[model samples]
Target: MDPSMEHLLARKKSSRSSSRTRSSSASSQTPSDQKPREEKSAPYRDPRYETLLNTKGVFLDTCDLDIAVESKNIPETLLQGNQTVPESTIFGEHQFEYACRNLQGRNEARIIQDISRLLVPSAETFAMLGSKHLEKVIESVNEGWNNCIPLTGTRPQPDYSVGFRREAFSNEQLDKLSPFIGNWLSGDLSFFMATYYMYFPFLSCEVKCGAAALDVADRQNAHSMAVAVRAIVELFRLVKREGELQRQILSFSVSHDHRMVRIYGYYPVIDGKDTKYYRHPIYTFDFTTLNGKEKWTAYHFTKNVYDNWMPSHFKKICSAVDQLPSHLDFGVDPLAETGLSQELESLSTAASSDIPLNPAEQQVATPDSSLCGVGAAKRPKKDVCGIASDCSRSVTVNHCASCLNQINAHPASFNIFASRPLR
Candidate 1:
């Protein structure tokens, strides 16, 4: 089955998780009463991979997978290692907790202010709508940001011509976009932050505000990940347009729920099946920290990354277009195709702070408040096939040996978090 179909077949945990499921091809064809309730719309970090492009090995066959748990004693050589904590600016578990404290609670105005501050100072070639236009944003969402806008920052703001909003594509627009989007047609789902030119958005984001300001169900739904993947497809289309003005590289789908934000950059990567390049997830950032306001540091880190890498992507694309007899003529190393990513950065990476502290452990700073402590938690599923989740179980990959082995393993320990048997 398609990975997307697998998600539809799987039982939903809540309402927020089901936001897109309603428009799922299978959902509309089936009675709503027969389908699982969509996950509640809560302010939480969701990490479930919904599409084939995103997920690897999901036990989809509905076959029972019962593995006898085996424990392996750590090797003495492996046990000796440096216990140094990661010191990357993008490390953010504590950062999320601190940022939340700084906001106090569901303070959307503050959130905008923080985002604006991050964007305005840089000399980057990007323009955004000013505070006045941003104010309209809170009003547009049905659940408006229930806070007054504050006069912020002394620096000169740009005469911004573009702004983004949370909008769902109308039927007409969807039909127009059908050719570009391929099999990923999600219906009427709202975009969180989208920049528009002449009412058309080339890039999009699905934002999730992590706060206790909502119900438990709301705090647990990270459904935006699925939405972001779909949006990336649209962003990819924007860059591939026929006009010279359209062939740009910043085209990407952004999913930054403040805490666990993944920016899936579309790049022409070599999928093993063919030597042809395919656009896939390239840039990712996960700052799972609790050191107050540090989580927002990712914005700064992103700006730095953009300053460092955006041009490289463009240059590489241009080099191909130039079509020199060979890269040797240009005096640029063949390996310079993806400069920054190849040298200083990773094309696909996930970063979590070494600090063992989790915000879920300390629900809220204020004792008298009602906050759903749903920190960005990663609940990896166990496979009945006993293959590593990353292993696709395709003809190309081999069966898992760990699943077949049993040394000093404790079966009960493996079952602690294990749920459904693979069918």
Candidate 2:
């Protein structure tokens, strides 16, 4: 039943007490019904929680996240052939060729293997994730991925780092980091989104492995998109130093439940007028449902995210140095919103700073100091009028301009502060 309807039913049930009291004094009432019932009447519980009562010695329960259709149901698989690439999608023409590239001929298998390693390293998945036990799985692959991808000639080489639950992130920055339903910004590993010289990130990802991962993929996916959208906006705001936070992102949440792997993608809308920040999700798959080429396509997309690299040939760059690209191919359209207030608040803070919108020139302001001692830890600076930084006159003691001018008028009077003993 709908949650609202359930709440309405609960309200009506509570009001039934007055009617029950009135019925007790009815014209024909049974003696058995006169007595009050047991006070320990148990409340209703959701059936999903009922699994706890029927558990055995060592039990494993799971909810499958894969598309429910059986393999034999359709002749042409949705995830396999040309149908996988939508006409309006942002992907290039040759998906497999892009993902499975090698120095010489082919290494599609290498990309797939690397993606597998990224999502789940060895047998340990989210067991130690989010806790302090072990670092997130993405941290393990950062260096390898940073080295494997060829340096892009169009832009400087990137130095992507897998930062895990970093405390250095500003509260403003942390707040805007996602589409996550609950708290997700503080923990888990995330890759920086910028290329070589830049520091801010344009993309980020979250990974979950094994059966439990599939159970939480929807939740994790929502959280990942939120972060990606805001991070993209912040990155653009820093670069342009303008009102538009129009950077695009390529973010994903990868989940490998047992043998099947599900990859999710997110992209920001291209139009500057449309401030939605992110679009509907576009997703692909590997493992069972997809064939060789299809699996390669998924792997290539993963590699792209790992490298902070997007294929923008024959189009403008997304780095803001060039014209904005038409769109980006992030994956499936997710059922989530970007929570724009985080970005708005971040921008508002920048706007509220000392820099005025109409100023033709700017000046740095300093505070006046009342301190007058050499050995003090925080000796007050003598910024008489705001000219302390540029003023050349040496000040040995705190003195007004009138006294200093009176001393300077007589050259011999300067000897009073020339480290001489008082006579």
TM-score of each: 0.27, 0.29
lDDT of 2 by residue, 116-142 (tens): 443322212322433222222223222
Write one digit per residue (lDDT tens) for candidate 1, span 12-77: 112232334334564244322121112122212232322321332211111122111110111111
- Lowest-sum lDDT 10-residue window in model 2: 5-14
The residue-level lDDT of candidate 1 at 38 comes to 27
RMSD of each: 24.4, 26.1
- Cα displacement (angstroms), candidate 1, residue 189, comes to 18
- Which residue runs does candidate 1 get wrong by more than 4 Å? 1-102, 107-110, 114-206, 211-269, 272-296, 320-423
